[model samples]
Target: MTKIRALSEADLPAVGEIYAHYVTATAATFDETPPGLQEWRAKAEGIARAGLPFLVAEVDGEVAGYAYVAQYRPKPAYRHTLEDTIYLAPGRTGRGLGRLLLGELIAKLSGTRARTLVAVIADSGDPASARLHTAFGFEEAGRLKAVGFKHGRWIDTVLLQLDLTK
Candidate 1:
C-alpha cells in the first residue's frame, strides 16, 4: 500500500536523494549539481517558516516520492502565489504515484492563503509532467524556449497555473 504523510526529520536524506536523481539524470530541474542534505534541510525549514506543507509518499516502507510548494517569488506582492514541485523515486513513474502525491498536495494547499499555483516544467522531451499538471486543472500560461542548457542541449520550460480561488 501507498501512504502519504507530513515530511519528517528522518526523511531529509531520502528527499535529498530523490531530488539528486533529477539534478543529475534529467532536465526536470536546472540545477547542474545535486544539493546536499543541508540544502534540503534549509528548504524544509524555509517552507515551515512560511507555514506551508511539505510531504512525502511511502510505498510500503521506503519513500517513493515527494511534493511541495513554495512562494513563487520573494516579493510581498507574490505572497499569494506559489510554485508546485513533484518528483518520484527512480523507476516509480507511470505507476500513479505522481497523481497520488499531487492530489494530496493540492488538498493540503487548498486551505492556505495562496490563490495561484504555478508549475515550471522543463521540456526534456517528455510530456508526462506537463500532462500531470494539466490533469489537475493547471492551464498552460507560457513557455520559455531554450532557456536552460544541460546534457548537451537546450531545454524549454512550460509554465502551467492553477487558480485556487475557484
Candidate 2:
C-alpha cells in the first residue's frame, strides 16, 4: 500500500535525491545546480520553521516520492499563499502517486493559515499534472512564456492555483 506521511529529518536524503533528478535531468525545477546535502537540509529546515507541510509517499517500504508547500515569499503579506512542489523518483511517474501525495498535502495545508496554493510546472506536455490539479479544483492561472531554459531549449512555466478557503 502507498501511504502519505509527514516528512521527517531522516527523509531528507531521499527527498534530496528525488529533487536532484529535476535539478540535473529536467526542467521540472528551474534550479540549474543541484545543492549539496547541507543545502538541501537547510531547505527542509526553512519549511519546518514556517509550519508548512512537507510530505512523502511510501510504496511498500521504499520512498516513492515527496511533496511540500513552501512560503510563496518571505514577506508577511505572502504568508497566506504557498507554492506546491511534487517530485517522484525515476521509474515512479505515471502511477497516480503524484496525485495522491499532492492531494494529501493540499488537505493538510487547508488546516493551516495558507489560503491560496500555486503550482508552477515546467513541462509542456504534462497532462497528468494538469488533470490532477484540475480535478482538485486548481484553476489554470496563466503560463509564462520562455521564462526558463533547460535541456538546451526555452521552457514555459504553467501556473495553476487552488483557493483553499472555498
Worst 10 residues of 1 by lDDT: 103-112
User: Distance (Å) between predicted and true CA of 49, model 1?
Assistant: 1.3
User: Candidate 1 on 1-166: residue-level lDDT in tens?
Assistant: 8999989989999999999999999889999999898889999999989988899999998999999989999999999999988999999989998998888888988778999999999999889999999999999999999999999999999999999989
The candidate 2 region of ten consecutive residues with least summed lDDT is 123-132
Global fold similarity of model 1 (TM-score): 0.98
lDDT of 1 at 16: 90
lDDT of residue 69 for candidate 2: 91
* Best model number under lDDT: 1
lDDT for model 2, on a 0 to 1 scale? 0.86
**Which candidate's TM-score is highest?**
1
Across residues 1-166, which tens digit of lDDT does each residue of candidate 2 receive? 9999988878888888888887898777789888888987888888888888888999997889999899887899998989988889999999989889988998788668989999888865667777878888999999999999878888888899999999
